[model samples]
Target: MEYLVLALKGGCMGVADIIPGVSGGTMAFITGIYDQLIDAVRSFDFEFIKKLFKLDLIGAFEGPHLRFLLPLLFGLVLAMVSVANLMHYLLGTHPVEVWALFFGLIAASIIVVGRRIGEASVSNVLIGIAGAVFSYLLVGMIPVTTPDQLWFVFLCATISICAMILPGISGAFILLLLGKYEYITGALRNPADPGNAAILLAFVGGCIVGVSLFSRVLHYFLERHHSATVSLLTGFMAGAMRKVWPWKEVLDTVTIRGKVHVLSEANVLPPAYDSSFMLALALAGAGFSGVIFLEWLSSANRG
Candidate 1:
């Protein structure tokens, strides 16, 4: 039952990860597994690797918390394999509805994280503001041309994996900015393609390297400065709402590798007080309610 619960949590993380402005780490935090997930990733250090190489399977598995990791990983992989293409289709087809849902999710997440601060101090407030402004500006940047080479893919994956694990920051958004989101997801959805195998290998290698190193640093800071870190992460999620906002006015389009994509967009008020706008509002409400339900379930489990 416990493993099943953890796997379900992982599925939630995977769903969040598939969206551009949503983070799996944010879902993990909301679902009460953030610290455990970070610790599990952090366990793959020098000593653990040594044990694995020496064929000390028991030591390796026990040391790294694989009992916890295996089910979570299984769920994550299952969701990725089953839903990646569905997410792509949804993003391409029902974008407004999808963004509306995630917008509500992130908004609720901000509130949830903010409450963790217990009592907000001026210092933490300033830190939170700084985080919000930085994230807002970062997400608004236009993408420039980047190399499609395998080495570049590895580097992007490394950076993206770091972002993926951080609360409030979305690694998929980072990949979108770097122009590699579609490139990598395409390979993931079709690994049997001739060249995609190499791409997936390099990408996974970089993810391993990034997660192993970044998780340690994150775990250290989180242990020492829990309140401040949560405050900043809250701000990050708050600011990220700009990207997830359901209504946007596209200013221009650009061609990337023969594909036309939005070059720039500005958040806009819904054009009219009409049925479409009202439906979007309802969807947002549904998303917000979903988060509240999840919170209730989390608390009930704890009790």
Candidate 2:
């Protein structure tokens, strides 16, 4: 039962990770496991290596907080492996409703994160606004391709992995911006594709380098300036809500290398008697309420 619950949470976290403008870290935060997650990741350091060499398997694992990490990472990996396909199917078949639920989840997430700021100081407020505007503009920009060179792949891995840890940024979206989303997704879908294995390996290598470097910075910020940083992250998430709005019109469908892709212009449903619109609203409301309920449950657990 415990494993099942963790897996379901992992599934939701994976769904968030796959989506643009959403963060698995944010999901971790709302689910009451963010600190534990961070500690576990931080535990994989030189001390752990020393313990490993000493043939102290229990000590090594405990040193790295494996008790917390093993289950959590199992959940996360399981979710990533499974949820993406499920989400892709749902998005393709019921784009509006799926997006509506996502919209609601983010909406409530913003509220939950916002309440963490104890006061509305000028600096914090400005930081929040800056975060919002920056994210809002970022999501609006057009994507460009990066040369698929080894160094460039490494660079993309570093940057995208850092974004993955941040609350509002999507690592996959970063790949999209770098023009590697389809490439990586293709490799995942068809591991045997020529050159795909190399590309995937490079990307993963980049992520490892990036995460190791950035986690320290994140730890510093969290320890030194906790509330301010959280406020800024909350603001970024709030701004990102624009990108995840449920309704969009397909502006164009283009074929690149024989694969068809849909490009959309974001839109809002007309305030009228359209059944689709009604359904979207209902889904959005459900999504919002669901997040709120999750927040309440998380708070109760903490208390």
Candidate 3:
């Protein structure tokens, strides 16, 4: 039952990962597996590699939290491969509704993370404000043109993958900011090509290097400064609300690989109350309610 639950949570993470302004880490947080996820990632360290080098198969196997990680990975990859296209279609066709749902989800996440803070110190508040402000500015920045070289792709993946594990920050959006979203996606579309395969190999290699290092840093801070860390993450989610707002005015766009990608956009108020507005509102409510239910379920599972 627990494994099944983990898989379902991973599926949710997988779904979130595909969206531009959403993060898989937020889903992990929502599902109450964020700490475990970090630990699992951190397990693949020097000790684990040493076991493999010595051909101590059992020791290598026992070093990492495979029981928890495997099922979760299964669900995450399954969702990414199986549902990615549908999600893209939805974002392209029913963007307003999709963004509305995610907006509610992120908003509720902020409340949940904020409550995790042990004390309401002035320092925590200030740190949270900094996080919020930084995130706000980050998500609102324009995408730029960047080189498509394999080395650059490796670097982008290394940096962007950090966001994949950081609650509230979007890895996909990070790639967009680095101007490699289309390049990577285009490679994904033609992965069989030699050049594409090489690009992907470099990208995956970078991700491995990234998590091996970043996970330790995150785990360390999470253990030593739980309150302050949660405060910042909460603020990050709060600031990300600007990116997920249901209504936006696209300022510039460019077509890449025959798809229109937004270069810049500004949030805007919905037009005079109407049926569309009501629909967005209702969907947002559903998303908010959904998170509340998930949190309740997660607590129950822990109990």
The candidate that achieves the highest TM-score relative to the unseen native structure: 1
- What would the per-residue lDDT of candidate 1 be over residues 9-102, giving only the tens digit for each residue? 8888887777778899888878888889998898788988898999998887777788899999888867876789999899888888889888
The superposed Cα distance between candidate 1 and the true structure at residue 146, in angstroms, equals: 1.5
lDDT of 3 by residue, 1-303 (tens): 878988988899988877778999999998889999999999898988998999999989898999999999989867866776787679888889999999989988887778789899999999899999988988998888788888899999899889999888999889889998767766765678999889989998898888889999998898999999998998888888889999988989998767677878888999668998899999999999988998988778679
Q: What is the TM-score of each candidate against the true structure?
A: 0.96, 0.88, 0.94
Better of 1 and 2 by TM-score: 1
Native-vs-model 3 lDDT? Answer: 0.87
Worst 10 residues of 1 by lDDT: 110-119
Candidate 3 lDDT trough over 10 residues, lowest sum: 182-191
Question: RMSD in Å for candidate 2, one decimal?
Answer: 2.7
* Candidate 1, superposed: residue stretches over 4 Å from native: none
Q: What is the TM-score (0 to 1) of candidate 2?
A: 0.88
